[model samples]
Target: MTSKANRPCVQKLRCLLSVAVGILCAQSLAFRNVDSAAFDSFANLTAKGLDSIAQFGPAGSIALAACLGALFYRIYPNFKRVGKRNQLISVILSFFLALSIVVPRLMKLPNVSFNSFPNYVGGVPKWHKPIFWMVASIQLLTIGFTLAVIICWLMRKAADLVECRNTGEVSTAIPPTNLSIWERGVRFFDGKPMHMTVATLAMVLCWLPMLVIQGPAIIGVDSMVQLVQFRTGHVWDPMTMAELPGYVGQDHHPFFDTYLYGLFDELGLWLGQEVLGFRILIVLQSIVAALAIVVSLIWIKKRTNLPDSCICACWCLAAILPAFPMYMSIVLKDSTWVSIFLLWMVAFFEVIYRCNNNHAIGWRLVLCLVVLGLFSGLTKKLGIYVTTVSLLLAIIVIRKQFAAFLISMLVPAALVIGFVPMVVLPALDIAPGGPQETISVPIQQLSKVAILHQDELSKSDRQAIDRVLDIDHLKPYWQADSADYAKHYGYRLNASSSDRKNFILTWIRLFFRYPKDYIAAVPYLINPFVYGETYYYSGPVRCGWWEAGGSRILTEYPECGLSYTQGKIAIPLTNALNKTPPFSFIGSEALYTVWLPMLALGLTISIRRYRNLCYLIPTVVSWCSLFLLPAHQVRYTLSFLFVFALTIALPFAEVLTKERNISN
Candidate 1:
């Protein structure tokens, strides 16, 4: 009896120790100037962030408390899954987490007034740092939960292994994993057919909030430009349009797609005013996005036999996460990109994986998936890579249908790459975009070097830069985190072979010397597409300070854009998330599109789910190429995150079906 009583306490203690260790390590390194200045800066930024939270009043405290409470509710189940003793201990941790919220308010400190200073330069406040305590307490709890999960998972696997060996029999137990727990991070609601229906309706209902909040369906400067060209028929104008990169991305950005999609604007004009028409178009887009999500969830339910309760849990996340309904109404290729990608994931499983030889997937199904992949790739650069990966994974999982799989992939790719760009673009009088913005990364490296190691640079280094781009032009354009400024200095559009060779040599030499700068510059650009734990809102309408001006149409129709006031819907929420811990958890890091690959990896670790490995390779291809992509916008990680969530649920569906057969 004593042993039983103590077990929960022991587990809880283990979690506590994990939390402590993780924190101590974080603190130890947080202050240390380890050779990597970037790592040190990241740590300091993290530390200073906490201090800034405390410098204010209870706002930071409340956000911290809310985030911790959210996490506790999220992870509390893992403990319960182990046993009742673990449940009791988890409750205690929950209590402490709750105290973290209350304690900050009680631990009073003077609010650092920013009004006194002419400029509000941020620094860690010296007064009692209540927010720090609130933050650290939650950090400890999170770390503890993570370690306990790993240890518990290992122990379960070990026990299963031993039992199988002793019995001299094959192990029937599907070793429990954090996969089940990890699944919750993506699960947002109690989803069922009804729940999904409600979710879809709710998503549609938010059309107004999305419209009012996001304002102007046209998402970016480039998107607005496309809308104008399409409206003015400049899109279908002669291929002689010299600024291929200017109208879209220097020959990228899929101008053909935007040209074709111009009917939405035409419909808007036909309906009445362009604004009203665009509004209708946006609402329709939201409806389509909602339908895709709803249908996908329902299909998962039918194919996998996953419990309605679990599906319901997954539903809420689809609704609330910034990548979904919010982006749905935003007028950008990403809205379509996410929708197509989600559909592709469903089709890959339902048509390719689930239906066996007895019900061989029809040509129509294969055709639909191929079409989706092509369109998705057209909308966003990464989609092509992701689509190719899905096709590869499909071939691997459905080895018997390798020929069919290869055809599906090749057909769509050929059409998109060969026919569309080569044959169709010429017919439509559209100029083909230039190659991938490969020089972006180099410019990023150069930008960082100009700032951090400018004095360290030799004349030879200067000459090398001049060969690729004018060195004098680059001097004024040094941004550490982005190449936007530096890229202007490069002559990538028409570089000679000799120019490329010298640029490569100079770049390599600089890399050998300033390795840290290169590392810093790369992650700074790519983190938004991968693992970024910065403070931002959990909604898609981040930085809602948009207004009409960049493009000709936007300049004429000023009301066609959105400019959210401070403290209004998304900005306030985003401010809290971007500034506070746990809340910040929902920021860019939450949207890692490579999550499907990550999910596949986790499931394959203990169980040799080689079928799952198919998802990983192509996404990795997409992720690696992000370093060379143009920008690190929130939309970059969209489809990967949502689709990966679907992939995570898939294996369980497969396992459950097998289990049912066995029981029968």
Candidate 2:
């Protein structure tokens, strides 16, 4: 039998989903498409102190209003106010009426603000009066409105079921409280796939405790560099006085990421007490990550009807997956990017198949694609290009999903092609500085070649090599095991374009003859991406790190502290965990999620169950993009791994479901 939902059921489900999404959107929409700094200013004031009462004073009233709104919708259907055909129309109208009231009231609700003490720290800029209130009003009102709409809808739905059971008629009355917690949960998740629900709850339970001991997991100097760059508008050289651009930092590290995290830092400033603000941010990150995991499982469960145990196993793996919580709590760009990319997969998974074969749902998913596609694309410099290429490849493979995927990418595709160059660059004064490939890939290979086959170099070749690097410097670097030969002792620091030309020619000449030499150096230079090896030339171990003078520098770096921050217990524990096996595998400089796409490729080729390569493609490309990067850090890929893991496993669960269906 086809899995498309029945008409009445589809409408009801859409209504319910819309309300749920609507409520979330209400609070979140204001934050969307707005300047990050405005929120930062709001958060800054909040950090100094917003009264606890002002923050949560409306809970009871808002809850009551929401319950009432749901009641209005529930009973309006029974009023006998309209004939059979109009019944659908009346119900729709009632939902809107309820929302109309709830939305306005919620928006008007009072929320805590920085009116009392606007400045968060000693010198950071404060929010302007108008922007501060605009942001706060949007957030506060949405909270109130969404709560009422959701509570009202939920209570009304429960009341309908209770009334249906007791009196053979649905009603608007409150639901009875005698049901067991399990039963209430069943009602709550009535139409949801059981496996999906289980997966969500499991992830929630797994990440809960980390909050109690949640310290900041500052991996290295990158986190500190970001924190410093945040205070300034642009990507600033932390070491340079007056924040002059550092030597080849953001270009190598991905400057767009600095922009994204800078916004988060602004939020941290807003939330109150730097440490506490960050913890809140971490908690928010965990929640969203869990939600993404849940959404991926739900989409999979819908497709496969996965067994409870298989779903449980998925959850178990997610729970133990070392990177999940570690990356979530850390103030890293990867964490946020991971969540966005995963959620984008939700639209991806939904579109490739069918959602009750509903066009409206498909359209909604496409709209989401445009927003998520653009946001995620713009977040990292290469993200848009990588994702665009992947989407094109996906269309070729999944011919059936071509229309949906094409429509989804149209807006973003346009912006990338036309807008980014003409508008974004000139407007933002974003200099076109990116991958210094002249140094990263070729130089590393040359260092390997020079070290392994010094005798092979002719006198002219030796002179040409010297133009790029002092061949003597290669010896000490080899002994020290420094992978970066391009920047050692200011190698290539002042080479003219002709010198660059000569070095490239020499690199290519040596590349063909001593290919094995290049092959030998590949292992460690790409160590972090290939496996979770944390041991490096910087030392087999150090607690904190950032790069400088072409080296990984270790230092204490929280950049900020808090009463409830997890820096002490969390940081040392994660670092210690990396030293061991099992967990050690998770420590790879590449994203742990990288394995999922690799696995998916293997399975998609062999097992028909694992065939949606769309989700896997971007991540695979992301992993490839790493080779182009100057450094090899796992944080670069950690944020993007979760979605694919869920997607790959879900297909297996469905394979079992398909087998069962065939047997039946």
Candidate 3:
């Protein structure tokens, strides 16, 4: 019989051989004194030797341990013990983890000068240096390996919960007969119209503190602008006697939202109390937002097999979360848009669910989608793009329901594309808001190039940029994270269509010619999404009652007789809530849901739960649009947070045999 490779003596000899090689490698690397050329002869040389030796021991130990760890890992590779589903999850998470590591670092990378086409002025430091590349690779691999192990362990626990859900092992429906008053009350409203009522009431109740403490409603500068427009028949900047341009009001602040605010202000005038009208408006707005949340929860409960506890938890979160109530109380377009967006998401999902299940397309659901779609587009300018793209995608995904989806968009599409621009806007004589808002991203890109690479810019590119923007003056207004100041401050109001066309052409050319600058420019855009908060107008909670430098609503419109007093106990209570647990995290823009959305998407895709994906389409489109924004405003993400809370329940369908597959 020949000696086997698995023999004990052979294994021992191999280990001994590995150790000997590792020590030799470490010594050779650490004790190389050739780079110590700075040392002078004799005395200096002796001192350098001591310093080198002192650094040698730790470096040698680390090198030897790394070699042994690599050998053991390659031989054992214990991660292979996980199931196929876990492996798939790990693969998905690995991509996300890599982005998490690379994107932030890439954002921080110094912009290297390009001396020639595709060649850097100074060769890339990380790539050119062997030590840097090797150390980075080793560190990334070590961290990734450790994280994968943790992921697998957590996934095992999740799989158990999923299994329990599938096997009907976990149920919250049954209530014992022996119960307290609160338990009895909960059981009583466990179903139907009462449940919806209770849910809506909970939200309204939570919002009351914001209303009572702040009084009437949280009136911001935008609210005053809307009031001035409706009251005076011309747009007026706060505190300034001068009127804005003749065409500035309609659809810029959105005439529909402004008109609603005006109606309430008129009611306040009729009642001799302007603030009373705002109070009524705030209460009704809260009701609408609360009802939308309830409707989505109701549909989710009926369609998915999510546990009662999860459903109830969602209801509580929407109702009790400090951020929701704060946003609800504010008088601005965002307050209205978020509610309409939530309702539209529910309608969108209803259509997809019916089509996928082969159920008949109901008239009620179609009408709801059409109506909600129109409101969504009308509430915000960006809504027009998001709604149109989403409906078009829905048509492509569920081709069999093409007629239903198309019909749903016809009215909203017509109003946004045809009626508003051609008839309504002109009839109202509102000047267009300009293209600056839509093209802020490109403007920011060009501004960066103008500031950093001015010397390298071609004459033609410079002329093209200068036609649309004040390229010579851009440096003073350019902000890394915001394009707002640059667009308004550096913008050329007289730039014609051709000028804009030239700028776009130049922007495209520069993007390809110097891609590193473009990449470097995007980190500011990614800060809020990847990390948590960015600069300006982003916070967990904001009471928009007043803004500095703006005329106070009470002072400017004193005839309307509004009061600015806060309840004696309001400040202390608000501060207490902000410092409290759960509420603090819930209200924190800093503690943004960085991982939740990623984890949800990964889990859903890994288990092939395609039906759940339909619920997330709007959020995906909305988030992608953020890259085009002038800056990262947290309020812009409010709709996403609302939809995500409900969609998170859908991934549990992975365990349900009946719901494993619903794709076309």
On TM-score, the candidate that comes out on top is 3
- Among these predictions, the greatest lDDT belongs to 3
**Residue lDDT tens for model 1, 494-552:** 66667667777788778888888787665445344322333232222122213322344
Query: Deviation in angstroms for 102 in model 2?
Result: 62
Q: Is candidate 2 or 3 superior in lDDT?
A: 3
lDDT of 3 by residue, 586-620 (tens): 55432233455566666666555666676566666
Worst 10 residues of 1 by lDDT: 112-121
lDDT of each: 0.52, 0.49, 0.61
Angstrom error at residue 319, model 2: 4.3
TM-score of each model, in listed order:
0.67, 0.55, 0.72
lDDT (Cα, tens digit) per residue for candidate 2, span 160-202:
4333434535233646676544334323222355745565666
How much is 578 displaced in model 3, in angstroms?
7.2
Q: Candidate 1, after superposition: displacement of residue 13 in Å?
A: 6.0
Model 1 CA deviation exceeding 4 Å by range: 1-199, 206-208, 216-218, 232-251, 321-323, 355-359, 393-400, 436-439, 446-468, 496-517, 529-570, 576-583, 591-600, 655-664
